[model samples]
Target chain A: MQYPEPIARLIDSYMKLPGIGEKSATRLAFYTLGMSDADVDNFAKSLRAVKRDLHYCSVCGNITEDDPCPICKDKTRDQSRVLVVERSRDIMAMERMKEYHGLYHVLHGTISPSEGTGPQDINLESLLKRLEAHKEIQEVIVATNASLDGETTAQYLAHLIKPAGIKVTRLAHGLSAGADIDYTDEVTLFRAVQGRTEM
Target chain B: MQYPEPIARLIDSYMKLPGIGEKSATRLAFYTLGMSDADVDNFAKSLRAVKRDLHYCSVCGNITEDDPCPICKDKTRDQSRVLVVERSRDIMAMERMKEYHGLYHVLHGTISPSEGTGPQDINLESLLKRLEAHKEIQEVIVATNASLDGETTAQYLAHLIKPAGIKVTRLAHGLSAGADIDYTDEVTLFRAVQGRTEM
Candidate 1:
């Protein structure tokens, strides 16, 4: 039997989210139905608040409440060294490390021809503008993932920035922390051996 | 660094859901931020609608948008045989099989002394009243889960209904389908052997 109207609509709405399927949507809809009125109202308000309050940072394309994000406006941060990531979420991953003091530039996406995403489609223009405007910026770290599209985008960015007389670097490839040497993949093992450091 | 105010609030709201952790909450909040404004509005509206519209079915105790749930109100179902389930969701599982044509009585919860849930706490009073009022009901198939509380609830229900000359039955227990013999536990294997039927 079909669910009641409101339940069905809620399930359909939940199905639009990323990684949520029919079963998960049904479960979430039912769970929402069981929630208290006050809690549900707060949840609904939170959903609207996300869209209503937050906007993209004009400087680096990161989502923020203000025009220039807190990260961009922070004078204490190392603005001379900027870490370029594929998405705003990547900034959180870097921040969790608590080591990097440099500012960030969110590309929003990588240059993927198969997915019809080109250099112009992403936030590349803003990154170039930011670099040109900020003469003190000495290094640009291309911290994209180690996928084909990521590598391609990194190469394209390096080609664009190198001619402008700015140093470009990619994240080092090696064995991950707590990973066993016996189970390590061949390519990573090769990189680890090739880039071995002398004590 | 922590997320902006709206984003942080959204993440906190998501973290309150069952089985969702901090990582999943963060992922969901970011995904919500990426959604279009129209999509976000629909999602928020759905959450509010669930709490605002749906309510308990007075007749069967199942949650519904109407007074009497569709299942309880249907004339085509076998009114003489009522499947007694612990929760409203259990009725959905039974209906998915497309075999059960009987009406249902949702108990809302089982009698669990450890959790402070008793017969009075659940929808048992309405079930007793329904049975007393409707002389057509001949059988009650207890479809509670195979847990300690479920077994206790079934026994209590049988003792209460048997005096009224109503046939009370419990769902059979055995090994589940697609389960490997090596991985199957001892108690289930014993039940499987004991409850073996002629082919």
Candidate 2:
């Protein structure tokens, strides 16, 4: 016997999310059913609100309710440096550290040969145009993840930005702060050794 | 920097789901933003639909769109037997097997001393009333899980139903088919030895 129509639709909707399978979808569906009515209302309202209210910031390619985003709108932030990341969530991680005060450019995705995601597919064109418009930006810091596609995208961005006399730098990748050398993976260990700092 | 209000609300909503944390919720919120408008609309619709459309089957306590549920309404099913399970999901599992043709009773939960869940907390009163009404149900098969609470519930059910001249049975406990003896846990191995039957 099939799950009733409403629950089956819910399970199917949940299964569309990354990493959720049939069993997990079923569990979530039941849990949703058990949730209080007001909470469910808020959940559905938020679901619609994400699409209805949010938009891509025209200047930075970051997700925002405002057109240019709060980051771009703020004239007080440092204008000389911009950190580039593959996704907007990386900006949250950076901001959480409370260190970086420079602007950011969200690529939205990385170029991958296997996936056929070309450089043209991502939000690179807007970044290029933004740089062309703003000569005060002296540095472009690539904070894309250390994955193969991320590295490729960073390299491509560096090559393109270097012609404009802007310094292009990649985030230093090494063994994480608390990670032990013995337990560190080979690639991380190799990067740690390669990027050793002067004492 | 804070995420935009809409996306932040969406992340908060995603975090309300079981097993989804802040990071995962952020990922899901972004993924949802990337979804097509139609899929997102459907997702929100399904969320609302599960709450609005489906309800408990008053007869069997299974989740259903209809009042009695398909199984309870069916006149062809065996009237002499009733399978009692801990949750509505269990009925889905049983129906998938297609081996049993009896009606079902959903207990919703098991009796657990540590958690302080008693027999009265589950759907037991209706079950007793149903039994009192339906003299044709000669046997009650307790198909709760094999945990301590499940066993306690089964014994309690047996104790209560036996006085009414109804036979109470339990799902067999032993090693599952294709389970290797060397890999089996001690309790299962012991149960396998004790419940050995003639070939």
Candidate 3:
């Protein structure tokens, strides 16, 4: 039996989100139906607001209500050190730790040849321009994921920045905290041994 | 660091959805931010439309754009039999089977006293009224779940409908099809033995 038009439409919209399947979309649609009109309006408004109000930060490529984003505009953050990440969401992760007080450069995505995403496709051009314009910036920390594409992007960024006489570094790879040594994957174990810290 | 107002609000709305946690909400919010304007507008509109357009069918409690609902209006269905279910979603499950061509009565919820949900809180009044108004309904099938509240609701519905001199039936409880005997719970195995068929 066919669902009502509105419910079907809602389910289809929900299915477009990442990781949500048919069953989950149906469940979410029903849940949305059960919500109060005010709550539903708020939810809908939030969805529109995210798209309508936000834009890419001019300086860093992160999403922001303002042009430069709060992080980029803040003068107190270390201007000499720049942490380059694959997406704006990764910036949130780093911010949550509260340990890093440096500026950020969002790549939006990594260089993936299989996906046909090259250096020209992502936010790499702006990073190079920013580096060229800001000679005081001494170090660029490449904090992309441990995946092949992420490594390729980091290496590519290093190659581009090293000639400009700026230090380019990638995040260290090791076994994660609370990980069991016996169950750790070979790559992580190998990295942990290779990058062993001095006690 | 706090997320931008729009992003934070979007994440908060996503978190309100069932089965979505903080991490998933963050992921969904970022995904929403990345969506094209038209796609975002469609998502937002769908949410609003589901709540604004859909209403309960007057004949049955199932959700629909029409007052009587398509199922209730369909003349080909067996009007003499009414299958009672806990929610509108359950009606979809029954419809998917393509076997039951009877009318439906959605209670919207069960008689759970601990949750302060009594018969008066649900759509039972309309069911009784419908039964009284239409004498042609030969059987009232109490297809509530097999949980404590579901059983209580089924028994209560049976008691209410039996005095009208109509047939009242509950769904059979037994081992599910393709269930492993070794892994089967004792209650299900016992029920399967007790409800054994002659065939």
Model 1, range A1-199, lDDT digits (tens) per residue? 7777888898998898778899888888888887788888888999999999999998888999998999999999998999999989899889989999999999989999889999988899988988999998999999998888999999999999999999999998899999899999998899889988899
Which candidate has the top score in TM-score? 2
Candidates' C-alpha lDDT: 0.91, 0.93, 0.93
Q: What TM-score against the true chain A does chain A of each candidate get?
A: 0.95, 0.98, 0.97
Off by over 4 Å in 2: none
Best by DockQ: 2
Regions of candidate 3 where Cα sits further than 4 Å from its true position? none
Using Cα atoms, each model's DockQ against the true complex is 0.71, 0.86, 0.84
lDDT of 2 by residue, B1-199 (tens): 7888888888888899999999899999999999999888899999999999989999889999999899999999998899999999999999999999999999999999989999889999999999999999999999999999999999999999999999999998899989999999999889889989999
Q: Residue by residue across A69-129, what tens digits does model 2's lDDT show?
A: 8988988899999999999888888999999999999999999887899999999999999
What tens digits encode model 1's per-residue C-alpha lDDT throughout B1-199? 8888998999888877777889888999999998889999998998888788889999998889988888888998899998999887788889888999998999988999899999999899999999999999999999998888998999999999999999999888887989998999998899889999999
TM-score winner between 1 and 3, please give it.
3
Error of 3 at B75 (Å): 3.1
The order by descending TM-score is: 2, 3, 1
lDDT of 3 by residue, A139-187 (tens): 9999999999999999999988899899999999998989999999999
Candidate 1 regions off by >4 Å?
B113-116, B175-186
Stronger candidate by DockQ (1 vs 2)? 2
Every model's TM-score: 0.92, 0.98, 0.96
TM-score of candidate 2 versus the correct structure, residues matched by position: 0.98
Q: What RMSD does each model have against the real structure?
A: 2.2, 1.1, 1.6
